[model samples]
Target: MHRFANPAQFNRLADAILPWATGAFVLLLGAGLYYAFFDSPPDYQQGESVRVMYIHVPAAWMAMFTYMVMAVASFTALVWRHPLALLAGRAAAPIGAVFTALALITGMLWGKPMWGTYWVWDGRLTSVLVLLFLYLGYMALWQAIDEEEKAGRAASILALVGVVNIPIIKFSVDWWSTLHQPASVMRLDGPTIDGSMLMPLLLMAGAYQAYFAVVFLWRMKLEINRRKLAVARQVSMHAPVGAE
Candidate 1:
C-alpha cells in the first residue's frame, strides 16, 4: 500500500487498468440489463414491476458497501495517516451518494406498484434515509473546513460514528415489523427467489461493483493531483525571494 502511495506509480497502474475497467463496466452492465429485462421471468406476486429489483437491489447493496469502504479508508487515514486512504474516502463519497439515491428512487418506483405509496417511514427505509443524510453531511464537512487536515480528521470521526446505523438498516425488518419485504434473496434457505430471477440480479450486482472500481480510480487520481498542486504552491510561497 505504501509503495503505491507515490502518485506516479499509482497513476501508471491506473492508466494501464482504466481501459480494462471501462470495458468490463460496459460489458457487464449491458449483459446484466439485457438478461434482467428480457430473460428473467416475471414474479408471480409482483408481476412486471418486480423487474425493477435487478436495478434497485444492486444499487442498494452497493450503496451500503461503498459507504463501508469509505468508512474504513477514513479510519486508516485518521489513525495511520495513510495518504492513499484520504484519497479513497474523497473518491467514494459522491459515488456512494449517487448509488444511495438510485436505491431510494427505484425503491419508490417498486413500492407504488405493490405498497401503493411513494414513500414510507418504515424502519429499514428510515434508517437508509439516515444513511443518505450521513453521506451528505460527510461531504459537506469536507467542503466546509478550509484546512485539509482538519477537514479530513473531522469527517473521519463522523464516518466512524455513523457506521453504527448500517447494522440497524440491515436488521430492521427482523428486529421489528415493517412494510418493506423481508430478505428473500439472501436468506438462510438460500434465496427463496427462483433461479431465473437470481441470475440477472447477481449479474447486475457485479456490474455495480465494477462501476465503482472504474469511477473510484478516476476520482482518486484527480484528488491526488489537486493535493499535489496545493503542496507545490505552498512550497513556492515559502521559498526565499532572491535566493539561488
Candidate 2:
C-alpha cells in the first residue's frame, strides 16, 4: 500500500489493473442485467414494479458507498497529505453524484405508480436528497477555488462535515414512519426478501460496484494526466530560474 502511494508505483499497478477491471466491469454488468430482467421473480405485492428495485436499490447502495469512499479519502488526504487520497476524493464525487441522481430518478419513476406521487418529503427520500446536494456542494467547492491546495483542503473539510449525514440517511426509514420501505436485505432479523428476488438484487449490486470502479479509475487517470501537464508547464516556466 505504501509503495503504491508513490505515483510511479501507482501508475505501474494501475496499468496492470485497469484492463482487468474493464473486462470484469463489462462482464458483470452484462450478466447482472440479464438476471435482473429475466431471471428474477416478481413480488406478489409490487408485481413488475419490484423489478425497478433491481436497479433502484443498487444505485442507492452505490450512492452511499461513493460518499464513504470520498469521506475516507478526504480523511487520508488531510491526515497524511497523500495526493492519491485527494485524487480518490476527486474521482469519487461525480460518480457518487451520478449514482445519487440515478437513485432519485429511478425512485421517482418507481414511486409514481406505487406511492401515487413522484416526489415526497419522507424521511428516507429527504435524507437521500440531502446526500445528493452534499455531493454537488463538494464538487462545486472544488471548482469554486482556484488554488489546488486550498481547494483540496476546503473540499476535504466539506466531505468530512457531510459524513455526519450518511448515518442519518441510512437510518431515516427506521427512525421515522415513512413512505419508503424499511430495510429488507440488511435487517437485524436477516433478509425478508425471498431467494428468487434476492439473487438478482445481489447481481445488480455487483454491476453497480463495477460501474463505480470503472468511473473511479477513469477519473483518477484523468486527474493524474492533468497534474503531469501542470508540472510540465511549471517546469518550462521556471527553466531559467535555477540555471542562472
Candidate 3:
C-alpha cells in the first residue's frame, strides 16, 4: 500500500492493467449480451421484460460495489494518508453515481411492466435512491471546498458516514414488504436463479467489473496529472519575478 503512495509507480501499474481491463470489458460485454438475448430463456412469470434484469441487477451490484470501494479507499486515505486512495475515492464517485442512476432507471422500466407502475417508495428502491444522493453529496463536498486536502478530507468523511446505507440497501427487501423482489442470485443456499439465466447475469457482472477497472485506472491517471498541473501553477504563481 505504501508503495502505491508514489504517483509514478501507480501510473505505471495503471497503464499496464488498463489494456487488459479494456479488453476484458469488451469481451465480457459481447459474451454477456449474446447469452442474455439468445441463450437465456425468458422468465416464466415476467416474460420477455425479464431481459432488463441482465442490466438492472448488474448496475445495482456495481453501484454498491463501487461505493464500497470508495469507502475503503476513503478509510485508507484518512488513516494512512495514502495519496492515491484519496484520488481513488474521488474517481469512483461519478462512476458509482452513474451506476446508481442506471439501476434506478432500469428498475423503473422493469417495474412498469411487472408492478403496473413506473415508480414506488419501496424499501429497496428508496435506499438505492439514497445511495445515489450519497454519491452526489460526496462529489459536491469536494467541489465546495477550495483547498484540495480539505476537500478530500470532507469527502472521505462523508463516504465513511455513508457506509451504513449499503447494508440497508441490501437488506431492505427482506426487512420490509416491498414491491422489489428479494435476492435470487446471492443467496446463502447458492443462487435460486437457474443456470441458464445465471450464466449471462454473471457474465454481465464480470463485464461491469472490468468496465470499472478500465475507467478507474484512466480516471486515476487523469487526477494525478491534474494535481501535478495544479502544483506547478501554484509554484509559478509564488515564484520570484523572472525566476524560471
Q: Each candidate: RMSD to true structure?
A: 3.8, 4.2, 4.0
Compared with the true structure, what per-residue lDDT tens digits does model 2 show for residues 1-52? 2434477676777788778877887887788778778988877667888788
- Which number leads on lDDT? 3
Candidate 1: regions farther than 4 A off: 1-5, 168-191, 242-244
lDDT of 3 by residue, 1-244 (tens): 2333599888889889999999999999999999999999998778899889999999999999999999999999999988888999999999999999999999999888877788866666778888999999999999999988889988999999889756766576546643445532222124378899999999999999999999999889998888788778887899998987
| Model 1 CA RMSD to the hidden true structure, in angstroms | 3.8
| Residue lDDT tens for model 1, 1-244 | 2434588888999899989888988988998999999998887777899898999999999999999999999999999998878888988999999999999999889887777788866655676777899999999999999988788789988988889766766577445543445542222123388899889999899989989999999999999888888776876799798652
| TM-scores, all models, native as reference | 0.88, 0.87, 0.89
Residue-level error in angstroms, candidate 1, position 159: 0.5
Q: After superposition, how far is residue 240 of candidate 1 from its true place, in Å?
A: 2.3
| 2: Cα error in model 2, Å | 14
**Between candidates 1 and 2, the lDDT winner:** 1
The candidate scoring highest on TM-score is 3
**What does the lDDT read for residue 76 in candidate 3?**
98
